[model samples]
Target: MTETAPATATPGTPTDPGTGSIAGPSVAYQNWIDRQSRNRRQVQVGRALILIAFLALWEVAPRAGLVNPMLTSYPSAVWEGFLELLAQGNLGLHIGVTLLEVMISFAVAMILGTVVAICLWLSPMLEKILDPFLVVGNALPKIALVPIFYIWLGPQGSIYAVAIAVALFITILMLYTGFSQTDPNKIKLARTLGAGKRQILTKVVLPGNVHTFMATLKANVGLSLVGVIVGEFQASKAGLGYLIVYGSQIFRMDMVMAAIVILSLMSVAIYLAVQKAETWLIR
Candidate 1:
């Protein structure tokens, strides 16, 4: 037997050496990738254009007397507020605190969610018993629990707990939904081949839920941030949420807007990290 040298072909088009016909690379996949790339670039450009237009309108509106700067701050005022924060040297400290809380919450929620999901998947009876409780828990207004958490965990840790609570239900729901919806046919096929529960879970169910986990992470990222901000709003002395609260009290709309912009950027950063992870995973 001889191993033939590997054949080289253009992306999307491949040739089989033995049959001298086209084969290997998938044309549809290549085209889809091309289209997706173009769409992504277009979306980014559109977002930039919209942002520019908004800032321009904001700047002109206040200066042209169409709107009040004190009520709706312009980009320049926001920038000035940011600079003041930077000069005060607590800007990074506050951001770092918030990011830390969000990351911790996101991590804890993801781990616990995945574990709980797997446990539920392993026991149908247990899942049935707890499904109602889960539905009720998920349905509960999380923000309403902030005061309870503050009293329970104290100011130092309540923020973290609040963040976790905000995201935990979503994570569990997404993961459990993924695990439950895995094709029954696939499980049965594996079982018919003498595969046990553990084997089926590892080889069939788990592998198929990668995308679900990625989606859950993306959602968890946003939820975690919201939780953190809410926690900070009522708990933390140092964070963007605290800054917004403080600014609002002082009637410094510019500072409040700056803090909000930072929060938005943080959310985007975490979500983009999830997207990057997904890209690496799919590749």
Candidate 2:
């Protein structure tokens, strides 16, 4: 029998079925990628369909005389109003003022709320003593306080008042719950490792409750905007809320709708930013 040439296999060398080259990606991985692409496309299609349907109805109802265009402006009118505002630069000024108020109030509320939460967390007695006060404060309608804030802090006083009203209860309840629910085993472990109360709180409690804090922050963003707008409604010469009041008083529904759209966009942006920050912090 003729001796067959011995098949030689190189050591530490991967062999391919045909070209002897390593594969790029597995079939499973490619399938997963395809699935993700498909899902994203589906989502895009759904959003486009919804937007088209809404615009179609918005345009048709008014044009068909089913709805009075003078009283309720269509999407095109709102778009035109937005373009006019952009040309005049007044829109930018209003947006800036509203943003400033929201940011300042939110910052103050965050700092004060965090400090109070920490204090309450550190002392069970203080939390218990303050619980009733917190309950009552949260229960009270914050809008009713706009006038009081205007009187106390002047017309602009609503900024601080609204921030406090919106954020106080959220921060307190979230942080208190987080503190109370601290993992006992982790606390014990830290103590065993010679960690002091301060160390435990700074290292363990704070980190552990980060998710809760983020959740509270997300909720407070909308609340903060509401407070600012409501405050503006009560007393303000500038801001989107002022724009709405001005537009309504003049029967410029287009302007009112435009301001509303701006408010909605701003709120969404703030919320999305908070979410991104939370994700980054957690990661």
RMSD of each: 6.3, 8.5
Candidate 1 lDDT by residue in tens digits, 145-248: 98998898898688988888888887888999999999999999999999998898899999999999999999898899998999999988999999999999
Which pairs clash in model 2? none
How many clashes does each candidate structure show, in the order listed? 0, 0
What tens-digit string does per-residue lDDT give for candidate 2 at 147-230? Answer: 788888888776668766877777777777888799999999999999998898999998998988888888788888888889
Which candidate number has the best TM-score? 2
> How many angstroms is residue 155 displaced in model 2 relative to the true structure, after the best TM-score fit?
0.6
Candidate 2, after superposition: displacement of residue 115 in Å? Answer: 1.3
After the best TM-score superposition of candidate 1, give how far the Cα of residue 194 lies from its true spot, in angstroms.
Answer: 1.5
The C-alpha local distance difference test score for the whole of candidate 1 amounts to 0.89
Error of 2 at 168 (Å): 2.4
